[model samples]
Target: ILHSQISTIEKQATTATGCPLLVRCKNFQLLQLVIPQERDCHDVYISLLRLARPVKYEELYCFSFNPKLDREEREQGWMLIDLSEEYKRMGLPNNYWQLSDVNRDYRVCDSYPTQLYVPKSATAHIIVGSSKFRSRRRFPALSYYYKDNHASVCRSSQPLSGFSARCLEDEQMLQAIRKASPGSDFIYVVDTRPKVGVTTLVCVFAAPSHGMRDEAMLPDPLREPHLQGGFAQPCMAALLSCLLGPRSSWRA
Candidate 1:
């Protein structure tokens, strides 16, 4: 019966929106336990990792199970999982459970990392800069930073004095932007700086205007958020509104 169940899940993983499965080995016996589904594959993976607290596995494998791939590729689709590399690449918190821990005190804080798997047809633009306001002791500090572009990834820790960082001119960044249909989705990795804690990463999605250049009208990164540091959400919404205008649905 257990074997039948495992086979069933393995088959589902290749087609349905799948969840992570926990594997245990004891007395030379292996067990696969399916985790509950979450928002998406990424969320499911994170939840399962937290449940397996203080993970000590010597080897971890992630099966693609993508039906679009060839049969041979799907059959041999298992790949080693590297948590550290994934965290860095995805801009995820090093402490898998940190979001939940932080929420206890800062209940308003977002509980997930900022990431977006942009479709190939869409173009993405990134901007990194500091606020115009300065502290008594320090100059404008590094503010917003988020990277989840699977095709091309970039993260910056340095502060930008002005609009010094331009995604349109950067060759590496352009690689992620493609000529796609007008109104296609655009991903923006933004920074949300709270008054009392570290800056929070936020991912914003918008569609480009059909007539205008394939770019977003971003705010002057050198300036302050419209209302202190909580401008990330509004900024994203405004951009989408501007791009889509009144005719299109403003759903991100």
Candidate 2:
């Protein structure tokens, strides 16, 4: 069942532009940040720093893989380390590195889980491994990173029907939305593709029988002419709450 799901996700990813997925971890706090394909390494490194600042996490780890490459080629996964204070001192030297370096340049085994200690965090560790079950379990993470990470204006003023839907699959996001809506009519669309990544795209639409509400209710930023992409999870929740209704409460 899991393998089937992973296969479906890989197919969907083929259609979306690729992007690097950044994971920030400090003690028990873990946040995922998606760096659009258009952003350069420096931009991504800086973004990681910006994300960690508020939480006081001094460092973050970014990872990326190319599905198009063969097994041996794919084994050479990519990783980047962003140390906020270190970067500040050295003016942020290039921090991207190969995943093999975690194993002292040894080739990583795809079939078995590999544990690597994070240099920036003494107690933190990153597991680099892939399996039918592991990929299926964390499918949402795979899809979110593979898909083009961006936000766009709602092309159609109408409700969910014509408006562009954004994916919000992170568990943190779902909990926020569920807490806000509770027993409301809100519907969650979860992408269950077997791929390594999957995300829930929130769709907001009222029935046609109910007349459209005033457009003023939506936040001004969401109505702008350009599409805003690469928003972190908290921002995404706030945006969704605004679109849903005034009664929605966004958790910090």
Candidate 3:
């Protein structure tokens, strides 16, 4: 009986026998109720209507409420994956890539995690300077390192580039990335999106005239649809093809 599920409430009629109330839910669940008493049906409808639409701002969502925390409770789930342990598995702190503490104070990139792994050639000064070139101060940071080839998959926000926007440090950073992966001449940029509307999902209300009027109710219209197939899907076929190629140990 979640009020959020309620979409459209239709009052059929209030005859002598009873009142037929039709409730269409967000999930397209058609709820047809025939209340025996006319007054009770009106009361129920009014109650449901009030509950569905909260008048107060805070009543909209339960995010304001804070549950009591157990002082004695100690959860060890957070300690499962220590930074050092993960780096150890990757065989890092080598010649190609090294651990970076430039963002330890979170001054360089507030959006990024405090801990970061950058190219070995790029110094702390270069890392700090390069942040200005990229969006949200998200400078290129190592996400994965292929042990065999010293190849790395660096993640970064879009570069703040325009006609005149340029940074020498950012250029040096790219060079450092290239240097890390020896024998590799060029870097390939892969766009995950297939096309404009092939894999694109629009909001239910965004394009009312686009699709059929009585279309299937989408549960999560806001959430970006998971890429089952894309032109250049990141972290998988696109990046791995450049690194592993058609024939590799990772082949299924």
Candidate 4:
């Protein structure tokens, strides 16, 4: 193993975490600055997850940037090159790598300069029933949209219809996650009153499946989520109770 010592500075201003010097370095030549970013920017990537019950596949969409995007596409913004070939290109030895369900209609071309667009519906259900079983899961690290709050019943502004109605009635705290994240739809039309049981909800965003850090900065559960408005106490307690509740009890 290579061994080296980190050089120390005599004086420096500390960050909120109270560490002296904003940048951390491994050696004289290697410098690192850890900028604080939003939590959702990190949390969406998952390798495996155990659900309470069986889950059905829903429409899946992936947002990506194509460095070789054409001029026409570039004129609009970033491009989404089909990454169905990712497993092949990555050269993983497992056959399961190629089993990605990339169905037709699940693709989209994002214009460049802009690196965001809604892809076709995914063929998998990201979340499912019973809360008793485990399943592998994968989602993009970054899901860019024009605004945040698309998942909020109050912010979506859609008429009381199919998707909108479900969003309103769903009691799952995770339901509103995508909307409060960065780069989601800005306007929310549904009401948050029914879901306002918690005054504050803390959401922790971990690094990717490859792992980035032991812990990422998590938002205060008592405060409003990053992009959405503040949460209420009752709501917070209810959600926490569910998360911390006895697992076996649910089944019993």
Query: Which is the leading candidate under TM-score?
Result: 3
Candidate order by TM-score, highest to lowest?
A: 3, 1, 4, 2
Ranking by lDDT: 3, 1, 2, 4
Task: Count clashing pairs, candidate 1.
Answer: 0
Q: How many backbone clashes does candidate 4 have?
A: 52
Q: What is the lDDT of every predicted structure here?
A: 0.32, 0.28, 0.67, 0.26
Q: Which stretches of candidate 2 lie over 4 Å from their true place?
A: 1-100, 103-106, 109-119, 122-252
Clash pairs (backbone) in predicted model 3? none
> Per-residue lDDT of 1-252 in model 4, one digit per residue for the tens?
011233322223435643332222345544333324323212211111111111322311122224586769676643455433332343321311113232223332111112212212212232121011111211221122212112212221111212121221122222334333333323221224332322222122221121111112222321322222455665554433333343443321
lDDT of 1 by residue, 1-252 (tens): 222122212212522534555444323454554445545555645544443442422222232123677877765634465434554554544221111221223222222223322224222222111111111111111122233222222232222223333333232222223221123244333334453332221112111211111234333222223223456677656645534555365445
TM-score of 1: 0.21
Best candidate, lDDT: 3
Runs in model 3 with CA error above 4 Å? 1-74, 161-163, 191-229, 232-235
Off by over 4 Å in 4: 1-231, 246-252
Candidate number with the higher TM-score (1 or 4): 1
TM-score for each of the candidates: 0.21, 0.15, 0.55, 0.16
* Pick by TM-score: 2 or 3, better one: 3
lDDT of 3 at 240: 74
TM-score of 3: 0.55
